[model samples]
Target: MNCPLQGERKGSVNRIMRELNGISVVVPFLNEEDGIRKFCNTIDKYAEKFDFFLELIFVDDGSTDSSVEILKQCAFQNIKQVKLVKFSKNFGSHAAIRAGLQYASYEISTWLGSDLQEPLELLELSYEKIREGYNAVYIEKKSIKVSKANRIFSRIYSWMMRKYAVESYSSGGISTIVFDAKVRKYLNENMEANSSIMLQAMDAGFKSTVLSMDFHERSAGVSKWTLSKKMKLFIDSFVAFSFAPIRLVSIVGVFIFCIGVVIGISTIVNKLINPNVPVGYSTLASITALGFGITNISLGIIAEYLWRTYDAARKRPVFIVSDVVTIKECESDTQ
Candidate 1:
């Protein structure tokens, strides 16, 4: 199908051929019906200026709303190539992005959210940098206009990732990223169910750089990411990428064992000093409870790791595509 915006300007064909290159923009969204149309329009506008052929891949993470329908409608309206991958159920934004990447046809693939908070102009800079030999270009948030509590939480999360998961974790937010085929291949091959894509990309040992940008407010729809989801992402990122949790359990176990020995020696010394002294039930109970709590926590952490190992071994597909609507099919139907 020919680009719909191609004939809008005089001598546009030559410009497209000379300045524009093909790029696949992978967008993962869940229940983003309010903003999907605006998001697509913004992408179209960017495509016009950059003169690049856009292969827009929208992965619908089982939106119960009209998101998939809106995507289909937009696909029919746009001249740029559009592909919709509808999930059977809500997998996750990361899973959706991974699914999109598998079907991407272009060498340069860019990831964007459906909320339209991130500026599309970053693509131009990212494209330029990638052309200059960078394997990946990441759009980093210089600052976000969020609640103070959220800001604090974000800082703590960032610190945890840097201290435990990966040192470059600060550069790994899922805002906007443009990567070449090499980076995409690396990610596809080393897929982890619970890991953050940005961290995975950072660990891929690619020549990458971050472009700092101001994060804008969402144009429409409330963020589907709840506190629980944020916490899950944090834990998943750490577990999938770092062995620090296991190390922490080991350290705590050793500390508890040493404390137990010290307490035993102290109790023996006290009993010898005062054989008639009554045993303090409260002290015995407190020590027993503490030991039990620590032991249970340690077991829980180990079980978490073991469960993830079993999940990986099962090799379940990260996402199941229930339906796909492509631009070519839409064009054919219209013709």
Candidate 2:
């Protein structure tokens, strides 16, 4: 079907106020129709507490439900500023996030999902810390009320993240974060709206500070991030940010080669000494191990960048403007 924004282009829309600076909260939402009021209220509360000129930019990311209308409902509050950019289709969170960052007319840019597991109170701390002297202030989850299995996996994930991605610091700790507009511009201009948009923020090459916090139960509709999606995010983060996984392939190859040499030497010694040691199992095992080793090496090297390149090559437009609610589009780009 043709997008709503395209239809709306011929109709009335939200009006933009005079642009303000300080902090812009970019919330990327899909089917968050039920939580818009609560989410906006929390943002209003935190904005007052922090005493910053705040604007809430909700990117609808092509929601196929009443979320756009719900966002429109909150637009009446106009607490400082409330803006929504409804995409023509589901360009996904990363695209919505990039749009918010680009549309953000502020000094610092931040994003929080509509799920509400991340609290508004932490934004106060993040804003304060960003002002103090850091390029970015990442909110690290100190505790989360997930299942025991999730907690264990989170630990292992964080450990692997620390070792490979950040090089020296720990990750998976950061759930929310705030960064200077300059750092955000780097990704907004260059990144594909594929996955793990946060990884781009982390890779911005700045002295980032971490603030430990806790994740609470959601305050609204169910999460869009399934276990499978989260697993893909974990893999994407590693593949997008570091090459340690591929390096492991090389390490495994060397270890197997060394082991094979030793086994061959031992087999010859045994044959010379008694010539009766069984060779069937050893030969079969060696062949299996060698095959596995080569397969892993090939997979790692081939995958190191193939998927990302494929996504880039597809060159999907980040967001389709079904219509404009606030900002006017240039004739060339829109036409």
Instruction: Indicate which candidate wins on TM-score.
Output: 1
Candidate lDDT scores, in order, read 0.78, 0.70
Give the poorly placed runs of model 1, Cα more than 4 Å off.
1-20, 75-79, 171-174, 328-335
Clashing pairs in 1: none
User: Per-residue alpha-carbon lDDT of model 2 for 202-223, expressed as tens digits?
Assistant: 7667878888777888888877
lDDT of 1 by residue, 1-335 (tens): 34444434644532342343667788899988899888887777666666556677888898888987776676334334677888999998889889999877667887888887787778878888999999998788787776777777777887888888878665334466799889988888987797788888987779988898887788888888789888888888878889998999999999989998998898999999999988888988998999999989989889988998999899998889998877442122121
Model 1, poorest ten-residue lDDT window? 326-335
lDDT for residue 216 in candidate 2, whole number 0-100: 85
Report the alpha-carbon TM-score of model 2 versus the true structure: 0.80
